[model samples]
Target: MPSDCTHEPTPATQGPKLLEERTIGGILVHFVAIPTGVAGAGIVYLLATNEFTKRNARNALDWHLTVLALTVVTFGSLFTYAEFTGQGVTDVATLPSPVSTIASVVIPTLLTLWFLVTFWTFFVGLIAMGKATFGTAWRYPLSPALVDRYGSELDFPSKWPFVIFVYVVLLPLVIWGVFFGSTDGAAFFLSAFGLLGLIMLLTPLTAVAMYLHGERDQSRNTDWKPHVAAFVGTPILIAAAGYVISRVFTESMYPPGDAMYVFLAAFWVSSIVYLVRWWMTASN
Candidate 1:
């Protein structure tokens, strides 16, 4: 049902050769968001020599763009509202009483929607990739059929620079706002939730980026080990250091608030570092 256009198998000599499903699936599997999937798709689309390969690449590229546009319009607006009101990433009690109604209703609803979109994109993308490997030319159900139908007319390569600006320039600034704007406990949690939501969205995008950029550790055939080391190990090491500092310097147990803050701080810091490294590889 997902792949509406399954390329019928024909002799290798007839027309264009069939694009390998595993190669496409592998690409889809790595697709995360701007820095990863979008950039990766651009890279693949540019380098692909075959018509079939180009079509699949174009389809993937357009889908990522569509998903990114939808996310920005929906979550971006809500997060902006949260920033302006100072309710989401700050102390809620400080806000005027009337605003609470909006906060209680809007934040949860937006968060749910954000998660649904993220899950839907990843789930559908993965399924489509798997199906494509079996002889179908898969397309995202929600993706506009612009690339396949008007392949000749659309100049997708021109958009790559804008995509790069979004990842390297715009996103980092936005994330900074979400984190620093959140000054209170309630704000920290809410903002953290929002930031984490972005990270989740980036997960798939980054995967594709790494793959296309040839950043994968060929020895392992995956980058899981390094990510685990950075994500899990860094937090643990920071926590231990915090505990020591609290005992030796503060003469009290490590402040729970500080602990949580440090954990978040470490996570984001590590995430940024990893993304940068991956992006550099992908860009090259």
Candidate 2:
């Protein structure tokens, strides 16, 4: 009887502990990968005892490598500028001009390509990090072939409908603000996120592409009652949170740009919560 009591509790406790470990592990690898790049991911991969952590680390490593490759455009732009002017590499912070006058179209065109490449990389990485944070399975778009080689599909159903709010509402708004493509004045206001207010946008389409390619969770069903409820509540909460943050927290009502930032942050955080909750409920 005594042995049964101690041993019984152990099994139940072990399961939750392992679950917590896996979740933490999954989050850690991605977080580390963001700053140190492949080296950070490789360290976690080497140390992880479980497959879940290892899988996340491997993907993070692949993602960083992809990002590195994409960043080559910046170097390409710099080199072309240098070759045109016949100067060696110098401080990038101070805008270095080509020592020689190259073709009029060359520098501007290369710079535009570099900017687009940078934007694309930023958006893709943002989506991958969001998936990791939301507990969704994310295989990076344009990730190296190595990410799939050892990655295994888990049996657990990875469906969460709240991911739609991300696609339907937040990201589009962010891109619009960044490009100043719309009349919303979102590009002007500096909120708590300030520059990062702009951060919460630009990845929806990339995420959608990932989803379409089966690089993300397979479930996006919006019809489930609880998910439907969450979906309905999301926008309302976003608006409300924005209002509260602006009116109650700030000195005065925030400008449209700042308000937009608050709303986006709220939308993203709330959507992730709903997705995780739905995942947990369905998994059980």
Q: What is each predicted model's overall lDDT from 0 to 1?
A: 0.55, 0.53
Give the alpha carbon lDDT tens digit for every residue of 1-284 in model 1: 59788897776665434454235533453353233555556556655665555666677777776766666666665655565566454423355657756766876776787677667767766675665565554677768865566667544542322332334443455467675664654445456655554454443343334343332323454342344344446765796777667667785654664565465556556545655654565466
lDDT leader: 1
Q: Which sections of candidate 2 miss by over 4 Å?
A: 1-21, 89-110, 113-126, 133-135, 147-284
lDDT of 1: 0.55
TM-score of each: 0.42, 0.35
User: How many residue pairs clash in each candidate at the backbone level?
Assistant: 11, 2
Give model 1 RMSD, 1 decimal: 12.8
**Ten-residue stretch with the least lDDT total in model 1:** 157-166
Q: On a 0 to 1 TM-score scale, where does candidate 1 land against the true structure?
A: 0.42
